[model samples]
Target chain A: MAEAVDVAGLVDRARDGEPRAVARLISLVERGSTALPEVAAALAPHTGNALVVGITGAPGVGKSTSTNALVRAYRAEGKRVAVIAVDPSSPFSGGALLGDRVRMGDHATDPGVFIRSMATRGHLGGLSWATPQALRVLDAVGFDVVLVETVGVGQSEVEVVALADTTLVLLAPGMGDGIQAAKAGILEIADVFVVNKADRDGADQTARDLKYMISLGRRDRSGPSWRAPVVKTVAARAEGLDRVVAAIDEHRAWMTEHGELAGRRLRRAAAEIEAIAVERVRTRFPAADELAARVVEGELDPFTAAEKLISGSLGE
Target chain B: MAEAVDVAGLVDRARDGEPRAVARLISLVERGSTALPEVAAALAPHTGNALVVGITGAPGVGKSTSTNALVRAYRAEGKRVAVIAVDPSSPFSGGALLGDRVRMGDHATDPGVFIRSMATRGHLGGLSWATPQALRVLDAVGFDVVLVETVGVGQSEVEVVALADTTLVLLAPGMGDGIQAAKAGILEIADVFVVNKADRDGADQTARDLKYMISLGRRDRSGPSWRAPVVKTVAARAEGLDRVVAAIDEHRAWMTEHGELAGRRLRRAAAEIEAIAVERVRTRFPAADELAARVVEGELDPFTAAEKLISGSLGE
Candidate 1:
């Protein structure tokens, strides 16, 4: 595959503000090919400089719209922004539809904002296997703010977003089952919550319910201390965009004050490393087709078969 | 923690139909501790015998009621049934609410029926990492049929159900987002479809919509053509369960006739082993807390740190 893009060269070009090199680096990461190790090493020194924000919620909650608004608000302040919209990969198609761009049409022509759609690509985790590598490339390209918008809600998405410096969970009014939103477990991870479509009748009620739910947090100190601030927004109308941006900024400032920003970044790094290790084992094992065939033939017990494959490669 | 139960002893007892051993084995699987390797090995040969039926739907769609009715229907036919209800691990408590049991009260006194609830327990995939192992235990205990009930609709749950021999995607009438369900990509995986609460208004429209969707599939010329049967069920009234069971049986007959059973089982086994390999790597990696601290200190970049960890333990 053209010897996979030269890692050092790509990193150098990305650091010199070449968007093409940044795109190439992300492509290598997304593939999870052999060039990943080299690419990762090349971009190692340039990362840890960008402020990463994670946006997640249930499907059809208007997260893409809220993300687009957030991006525009940041760009309005003259800051370069990078948006990574993570789309779920279709197993049958082996590709993501990536309809997120349809919602962020305004940012497409803005030179200061870079938007890329990433597919999970059969990765178990909600984020793509190459996400960390891609983030490094974006960081190297000097994006002051990097926002990761996850495609769906699940434990994997939660874990991926936990890597972000600030995580915002978007919930829409009149979803009918407000409890369903809570059941998605997004409430626990959100540093800031937004009730989009605030013009709806139940917008205030949803905010109240979310606040009540947040007050039920049992782990840390209670009341408003561990509560996520609920912001009301009409993303389509761009109303309350300033308040949403201010809340984000306030959360960032709080993290910095509490020294949680550095801690969160560190955890994110550790999680990235752990994910990479797991990915290595997955690649070294026999292909799924081969293993399936063996299991079907009764030639190997799945447990023993898996053990042999894993231990033979990585050792228990 | 307590010398992790002797795998050989547990396997022997489970094979002899000891209830305690079966329960213990399932607990081991649910915890997904280091003891999993031994447990998986001991139970490996016992699997590939039970027919796995996976049931999934949106929450409050009466999935639990339908599952209960199915169990009752199967038991009435003199078939021994085992149900494994998968739920989200409570992030706040780490304990599963195990609400499925409350809906399955009728089976409480049935000696031939065994029901267990499994929490996702942070497994990257929607399934409990120990799912295959639990199934093996149930199979060894001589359950004629095993039913896997997934918690709510999402990618992970849908995927876990896809691993089953026959996947039944449940739906309710008046589901405001019937179209959203279609877009969620659930339609493609279902082998048998059930529209629960069929007495409700708009039920026919939902059924018609689903039938039209299924009709879009290309016809197969080889073997018995499998069409996803749409069954209407009012589970509270114990209505239409027979048709659902018949559809499952028909699917099984078709699978047996076409020699697809062995292939499907093999695929499931292969996936189980692949998951094990990935889990092993996760366990062997450094603790997340320590790595996170290093990243926070800026002593190492996430990429370089991850590369070092993976290369050191998992690479040649």
Candidate 2:
């Protein structure tokens, strides 16, 4: 058995801006450690204070560069910033990527900034189970802003939206046009769109295409809904980043005014709670292997096996 | 109330190779219909006959062309083939991709060939829950071969691997080298490797790089293990596809000899049963919304709320 963790002590240190303490807390979340309940109980009251921003886009869309730029922007405004860079494709997890840190430059030494990369390899429920817990950790640890950066592929984009109060979808010219973005379903979840690499040749056409698509999609909405604004940025050179920041701020303000922020948070909390509850139930069913063997031998169908397992475990 | 489905009649027609019956059964699986338990019970005994080959590759890697070529190759052997082309990116779902049909012209009219495109948008557990069930339906419908094709990204690739008897990972010359493939964790699950678009420049270099990486990775394995063979193919032109077919056959034979085939199927069945059980538990916990509201309001932490929910719902 693992030794008991001093959850309250860790939370206190984390709140005092001790980076290692914050890192340890997040590590517990990532591992889905047994002490998580104690940790959650200790950290709960301090959370709900930080602004959670989700940044996502396909690979080569300048997500990390834009995240670095935004971290600098947030830091300049005298706010402590934490970045949770989630690489669903990565199998290894440690601190932030060295390559990304090199691009991020001076922020490495700044005490006000913390960066961590999370890998979802071999984890059940993947990001949906771990990410929100990590966010709660950072939120409780006194970060004024937390940026969740994830690859925009498969279900990760949707999962990120479920965890964030505001989501930014990034695109680059020549990578794909507006229709392709819509096909990927990014248009549905984006609170703000960032057309990164604005210096590229087709930047204006991409932005125009996005605006047209946005207008086409908005035709059916009856009430007041936030129209996602498109902002262009050459993030590598740190050009046009101010507008991206402004758009994000505007989105936050709009959500706050319309009570959408509270609604999103409640949904996120519900999702987190449900994910945890399902996982707890999963652990109680140890007969899954035997049931599966029977299924392989053609003695039972999968659905019936599932029903039997549920009743056997839950005593229903 | 929805009318009860005549699942037994549908299964009988599906077993008789009736295309409409097969399609309807698969549709039920894709939709996660209320009739799923009845469908599973009927289909269970007839499954375990088809050879499931999972084809996955990053976008721009000629996955569709390769799948089309392989379908034709299997057809030439008088094998009835069913293709489940899963597009996680596409929100629209119906039959096959029309563009793919243009390339696979003759097969569109072939009575032995069946193709369907499934979209994972808004589905819980995404492909993991649905794809295996669809595979089961195809298996039960008397297809000699089932080719499951999906984009290689994030967790979908891993999920596909779990559902396939043999998984073929495709790569192109220009789309990152062997190191990049390894970083994506594809190297671990691939039973065979196909270097599609081999007519392009640098194909030989890409093949060599993959071989070197494979050799490096194999050094740690102690006993006899399947060394994934790298096959080259210009799939669009149907060049060098015979070797790809041979490689898949060889992998299947090797697995059967080593008893790994039964092992893999058992694991897949276990996963399916567990996912269903979790979903069942999730439905029983109607208190999740109220619990989530409390978490959002800081009246309860998520882990504690989850604990309360499990106990309340399961009477634990």
TM-score of each: 0.70, 0.66
Tens-digit lDDT track for model 1 on B202-290? 88988988887777653544555678899999999999999999999999998899888877776677677777666655555655556
Give the winner by TM-score. Answer: 1
Considering only chain B, report the TM-score of model 1: 0.83
Q: What is the DockQ of the complex in model 1? A: 0.31
Instruction: Name the best candidate (by lDDT).
Output: 2
lDDT of 2: 0.86
Instruction: Give the runs in model 2 whose Cα sits over 4 Å from its true position.
Output: A1-35, A38-255, A308-316, B1-3, B57-78, B87-113, B122-125, B151-158, B169-189, B194-213, B230-244, B277-287, B308-316
User: How well is each residue in A57-131 modelled by candidate 1, as lDDT tens digits?
Assistant: 778778878888888899889888998887766534634434645754787667678888777656444364567
